[model samples]
Target: MLIAQLTDTHIRRPGSLAYGVVDTAIFLEAAVAHLLALDPRPDAVIVTGDLTDFDDPQEHARFRQITAALPMPVFPIPGNHDSSAGLLAAFPEIAGRCAGGRVNYVVEDLPLRIVMLDSTVHGRPHGTLGAEGLDFLDRALGAAPGTPALVCAHHPPFLTGIRHMDVQNLFDAAALEAVLRRHPQVLAYTCGHVHRAVTTTFAGLAATIAPAPAHSVSLALDPAAPPTFHMEPPSLSLHRFAEGRLVTHRSFIGAFPGPFPFFGPDGRAIAG
Candidate 1:
């Protein structure tokens, strides 16, 4: 099974731009096209979060309109920039799967089970999976112990070196780790909100932060660096489940140079 991960879309209303600079909508459109063009298209798309610049109904609607192009299922969770109610309202189909107004649910039809969690803290930039969310995750993973599962959320449970973004990371990570440690079936913990692609290990499990299809958070390792973004090449994560392992690949968006041959027509190595 192949699952495409798209995060931090930050879509806005039709005429607006995110942060007065990025036309996130256009970026997402390109991303949609890129996904559609994939030779073996993803079986499903999991959007980690930040689906809108603002948690506005119109913004959510716009996000929906743009992603509706994908024929596969698109699962989303609430990020700091998004609200649970907003997401539920926009994608009512998922409403029945969630409870207590939190956008937490499971995708069971696929070979790799997906447990999407809500880490958004209302009106705040940071994230946390509180006791309730932790319990939900524990229960979800425990329900199917033999299934290989991937856990997803909006905020990363671990810190990235980017100071500003780190401050807003999932605060209750230790608690989250404790829960995940008990569930050996979890293959990885994936998230977004940092606006960059990052990989690390949490509780001995593969953890990744999917890059956005729009602007990327400036890569500043210094503790004093200010929060900023760059119009870097947008990208998405493709997770392929095979041979009892989950492998992730970063697929950049947009056109680039040609795929030139590495050898001559006679099958001889082409020397530079």
Candidate 2:
């Protein structure tokens, strides 16, 4: 199965730009087009978080409009900028699962189970999986002990070295990791907040932070450099599950200058 992960869309109102510069809505539109154009189209798209820039109703409506046009199903989880009430209001189909007023839930419609964890802290910029959240995870993982699963959360559970973004890293990392460790079936912890295509490990398994379809967060490793965004090439991640293994590939959003043949005219290997 091919699953495309688009993160940190940060879409604002139709004509508005996020951060007064990046037109995030346009970025996301292009991203969906790119995903649809892939040789083998994605089975579904899981938007990890930051679906809107300000959690505005207009933004959410626009998000719905864009996604509703897609051929495949798209599942969205709230980010720091999102509100559970706002998200549910925008997509009523999920009201049942989010009835308790939390956005976390499990999706078993696909061959692989998707455990979407709501990491948004109400009115806060950072994330935490409190005692209640942790208990929910334990129960979810326990129920699907042998099923291949992907734990999708907005904030990554590990320090990403990007000092500015690190301060907002998952507050209950230790607890979250412990819960994940008990679930041997979890293939990885997928996240988005950092807005960089990062690979790290949590509970001895793959943990990935998908790149944004909008601006990418600058990869400044210096502690003094504050977190910032740049108009770098937009990108997304493709999580391919085959034969009981999940392989992730990072793909950029725009057209490149090539489809350059890898072989010579005479059928010999092309040399660098």
Candidate 3:
């Protein structure tokens, strides 16, 4: 299965840019167009979080303008910048009304179960998967024991070594790790929060964070260093699973200003 992961779009409403700088609406349009142009279209799209800059109702309305109709289903979870109520109010179909429209949800795509967890605490900059979210995850995993599942959220369960970002990571990863250990069927854990393409291992499973679709966080590991942004090409990740193994590829859209041949001199084309 080819699952496309898009995160940290930080899409801003028309005339409402972020930090008086980024034009998220324009970038988001480019990103969505890029995703739709993929050759072997992804079976589904999982948007990890930060769908909007300020989680405003108007922003959600603007988001709908860009994503209202796509070839594949788009699933989303709330980030620290999102409002659960506002998100549901916009994408009521995928938000799935459960426990009073909680953003945490689960979907079984046969042989693969996706557990979308909620980490937003409303008005908090950092994220955490608390008791209720953990319980929901436990039950979701228990539903299909033999299937290889992916636990997805907006916050990484472990530190990313960026000290300032680490301080705001999931507060109960240790507790969540205990639960994950019991469920060996889980293939990996994925998230997006630091606005960069990052990979690490957490709780014995591969963890991946996709790059943002607009900009990148500066490669600064020191806590005292001021945070910075770069025009580095924004990207997304595609996870392909077969034969019980998972491989992830990061694709930077609207990048690489070059023109190559669809077919090589040997009359064989390379697949991107």
- Where does candidate 3 clash, by residue pair? none
Per-residue accuracy of model 1 over 85-194 as CA lDDT, tens digit each: 98999999989899999998999989999999999899999998899899999999999999999999998878799999888899999999999999998999999999
Q: Give candidate 3 misplaced runs (Cα > 4 Å).
A: 255-272
Q: Each model's TM-score, in the order given? A: 0.98, 0.96, 0.93
**Any runs in candidate 2 off by more than 4 Å, and if so which?**
264-266, 270-272
Writing each residue's lDDT as its tens digit, candidate 3 over 162-244 gives: 87788888888998898898899998999998888899899899999888888787878887877677777878889987898
Best by TM-score: 1
Query: How high is the CA lDDT of each candidate model?
Result: 0.93, 0.87, 0.83
Which residue runs does candidate 1 get wrong by more than 4 Å?
none
User: Candidate 1, which ten residues in sequence have the lowest lDDT sum?
Assistant: 154-163
Candidate 2 per-residue C-alpha lDDT over 1-272 given as tens digits, one digit per residue, 9 for 90 to 100: 99999989998987787778998888878997898799899998898888988899999998888887679888888899988788888878776775478787888899899888888898887898788778888998899788899899898888888988889878999999889888899998899998889998888999999988888889899899976888888899999999889999999998899999999889999887
The predicted structure with the larger lDDT, 1 or 2, is: 1
- The candidate with the higher lDDT, 1 or 3, is 1
